[model samples]
Target: MTPKAKAATGALTLASAAILGAMHLWEGQRLTVYADKLAGGLPTYCSGRTQPPRPVGSTLTQAECDAIDRQTATEYGRAILACIPAERMDQNSFDAMTLFAINVGKTAACNSRAAHLMRDGQRENACRALAYGPDGRPVWSYARGVYVQGLQNRRRYEMNWCLKLATAA
Candidate 1:
C-alpha cells in the first residue's frame, strides 16, 4: 500500500479504538452512579410488629423517605425487573423504573398500564403508554395523570447518554 494510504488507515483504526474505550468508560461511570444512588437512599422495612415511621397517617421525613426509597427500590425494582422479559432494562429503564417504584410504591406501578405493556415485551408501546400528567399533559399527580413524569424525564436523559455511549462503544 502507498505510504499515505497506510497512515490514514492506521489513524482511523486508532480513532475508532479510542472512541470505543471512551464509551466503555462512560457507561461504567453511569452504571456506578445509578447503583450508588440506589444504595445510599434505600429504605428499611420492618414487620407489622414494628411501628411504621408515620403510624399509618403522617407525613414523611428524610428518614422515612430513605426507608421507603430503599424498600421500594429493592422490592418493586426486583418485581418490575422480573416481569420485564429483557434480562436488563438498559440502564435508562433501570433508573427510571426504580425511581418510579420508590415514589409510587411497587404495587401501584407494577399494576400500571406501562408495567403491563413492559411485561408483555412491548418496549415502544410501553414507552408511549407511560403518562405522567393530567388532561394528556405532564401533571403533578395521579388525580388526572400517571404522576411520574419528572422521573420519566430523568430516564430520557439517562437513555440519551447511553445511546451516545453506544455509538462510541
Candidate 2:
C-alpha cells in the first residue's frame, strides 16, 4: 500500500474503534438489543424468499431488512466469538471478523484455511494461504485465501490499536 493509503487506513481504523468503544461505553447492551428487537426473528438476508425466482423472501421491507441485518450481525458475532481463529482476540478483532462475516457469509468466513491458520497462530503463513484461488481457479472459485488475508490485515490493525488502548488505560 502507498504511504498515504496506509496512513489513511490507520486513521480510519482508529475512528471506527473509537466509535464502537464509545457506543459500548454509553449504550452498554442497547446496541445489540435494539438490533434484535428490530429483526423479528425471521429477518434474514433472504427476507422471505426461500428460493431463487422467488422475490417473496428476496428482500424484506426496509424496517425488516435493517432489523434483520442487525439481528443476523449479532447472532453471527456470537458464532465467531465461539470459534475465533485466535485465542487472544479482543472485541476489535471480533468486530472486524463479524463485519466481514456479515458482508461475506458466516460459514464461508469461518471455514477458510487461512482463518484456520490464523487461529493456529501463523499470521504470516496464514497470509500466504491467500491464494488467488485454490487449484488455479479464479477468485470466482473459492478465494478464501484472498479475503481471509484482508480480514487478517484488518484484524491485525484492530488488535494493534486495541493493545495500544489497553496499555494507555
Q: How far is candidate 1 from the true structure (C-alpha RMSD, Å)?
A: 14.9
What's the lDDT of the predicted structure labeled candidate 1? 0.40
lDDT of each residue in 1-169, candidate 2, tens digit only: 3566335333222223443443233223221112222223422232221112322223345564445444555465655555553343434444555554544467875786645765886544433343323353223122333444433444344334433322212
- How far residue 24's Cα lies from its native spot in candidate 2, in Å, is 20
Steric clash pairs (candidate 1): 42-70, 43-67, 43-70, 133-139
All candidates' lDDT scores? 0.40, 0.42
141: Cα error in model 1, Å: 2.8
Off by over 4 Å in 1: 1-51, 54-72, 86-88, 132-140, 143-169
Q: Number of clashing residue pairs in every model?
A: 4, 4
Worst 10 residues of 2 by lDDT: 30-39
Off by over 4 Å in 2: 1-59, 123-169
Cα TM-score per model: 0.42, 0.41
Q: Model 2 compared with the native: what TM-score? A: 0.41
lDDT of 2 at 96: 51
